[model samples]
Target: MSEPRLSSLRWRVTVRRHPSAFLLAVQLLSLVLYPLFDEMRGGRVVFGAFGVLALALAVWVVNRSPAIKWIAWLLAVPAFGFSLLSVLFASESLLVLSSALEAAVYFYAAGSLIAYMMSDHRVTSDELFAAGATFTLLAWGFAYVFVVCQAWYPGSFTGALNPGQPRSWLELLSLSFTNLSAVGLGDVIPLGSTARVLVMLEQLAGVGYLAAVVSRLIGLTLLRHERR
Candidate 1:
């Protein structure tokens, strides 16, 4: 094969061999790129490119294990829908909504895939950490954006705060994430039942998922060590 062909074929094989790694790289890129181009122009391009790459990778993954088709299809449906809306939508608010939804889906997909790998107990430590770290990066970005944009939020981000809260957009974004991560920063106080409950949900999901998956990985590693 020519060099270009070889590289393309190699990526295919690599993705098929290591779906976790492929997903990790894509998730990491999405996290970093999302905030930098919140405007959606540059984001659309990157998102489309990643989508194409993911589809290609998915082809290999599905061929090897059709079971992954379930996950791949679920992730792809929203990702593709958001991408389409982001490109075709007439209103900026619609686009923003799509982008935000895409972030949630991406985070969930990354988390679920990592969870799957952890349960496999066959993935290498390097691959596991790399995937976990990528997922963490997305979580960090999501939380950071929530904090940075706190001031501009018109209502309770997670139904916890009021529209009149005196916050800058950045502050709200940061606080949203801080609450999401369950950091208990103690600065953004929830004034209503919705805010308090929302805080707990975000915190619980953020910490619980990571902790559960990380523990599973540790167990796998320990099991392997015992075997050796």
Candidate 2:
């Protein structure tokens, strides 16, 4: 094949065979990119576009799993549409709607990955990748939930730099990661009852995920080796 055709074929094969790796890569890359772009003027538009890309990749990852692809599409279509509309029109209501839908989609994707990893006795390379991808998905989903909470109840979170001021997306995301990882190092603190409740739930989820999913994978891997 020609060079162009070869490159296209490789790209397609990678997406087909290792979609979870791509999803995980994009999510991690965003952690670095988000902070850099956020300080610049007109950064919100770029942030919105980046969100749409991540959602699209999530849909792709979900489709590769044993998930019902249509369900992911159903949630993602409106999520990204509302996301773009909010960016274009600067509508607060649309942004809230989009964030909610996006959170739902991410949760669904994470569930699908869990199901995929637990479905069979044998562990595949994709399943291994899915494990990490699922964690990031949960973190992103919870971040979106924080976004909605902040919108509904202003001053939901406080940070060291701007106490009582509305938290930025990066700050919220950092909070989510710290909470979900049980790090307890985030500067953002939940002030409202609603936010505190959500944070507690995410902390439980983080512990349960490690106890359940991680343990199961390790046990299964040991069993597979014993059988071999």
Q: Which candidate is the best by TM-score?
A: 2
**109, model 1: CA deviation in Å?**
2.0
lDDT of 2 at 41: 48
Q: Count clashing pairs, candidate 2.
A: 0
Per-residue lDDT tens digits of candidate 2, residues 3-97? 99999999988877877887888878877788788775435435554654665665665465445666777787788788788867878898888
TM-scores of all models?
A: 0.61, 0.90
Model 2, 65: alpha-carbon shift in Å?
9.0
Candidate 1: tens digits of C-alpha lDDT, residues 1-228: 699999999987776666666665765576566666666454543464364346435333523456655555665566556556656655445445544544554454455455556555574844574545444444543543343233234344433354455443334445655665566673556554555565566677677666876666777778888999
Pairs that clash in candidate 2: none
RMSD of each: 5.8, 2.3
Q: Which candidate wins on lDDT?
A: 2
TM-score, cand. 2: 0.90
What total of clashing residue pairs does each candidate reach?
Answer: 24, 0
